[model samples]
Target: MARMFRVLGFFTLVIALMSFAGDLTEMSLLFFVQTVVFFLLGYLNFTEKTYILLFWAYMVLSFLGFTYWTVFRMGLPF
Candidate 1:
């Protein structure tokens, strides 16, 4: 169960990144949804301490990427 959650979280992160890289214009919805899912999965699987650090790093990077894409690429008012 825990391993499955970890795998899902990892894949979510990858999908989020790929979505961002593929189409910044169309990624807003997908990225947002994936991020929310990643957060929920991470929270629910908090018992896995080994991957916690990596997860946090991925979260931070994803957030920064999303912000950058939205504010700079999409030209949305920050």
Candidate 2:
């Protein structure tokens, strides 16, 4: 689980760099923060269940945030 988190952190770092290159500074900062968090959490000696729960929480929060952004911020003509 820790290894998985580390891998995710690495991927998020890549995303952050790409976003920065694309001039999406806000998104790049967000991903950079997440990368730091995941890396920190990866170093912690947490139980497997805790890690799984944390991952689930992260997923739910991210999904809700994305939904909110699309529905309210995107201003789509619907």
Best by lDDT: 2
In angstroms, how far off is 34's CA in candidate 2?
0.4
Could you give candidate 2's per-residue lDDT for residues 1-78 as a string of tens digits? 999999999999999999999999999999999999999999997999999999999999999999999989997896
**TM-score to true structure, per model:** 0.43, 0.96
- Report the C-alpha lDDT of model 1 over 1-78, residue by residue, as the tens digit: 456555676776677787777786466466557656666765665566646666677679879998998888899654
Clashing pairs in 2: none
TM-score of 2: 0.96
Q: Enumerate residue pairs that collide in model 1.
A: none
Give the C-alpha miss distance for residue 7 in model 2, angstroms: 0.4
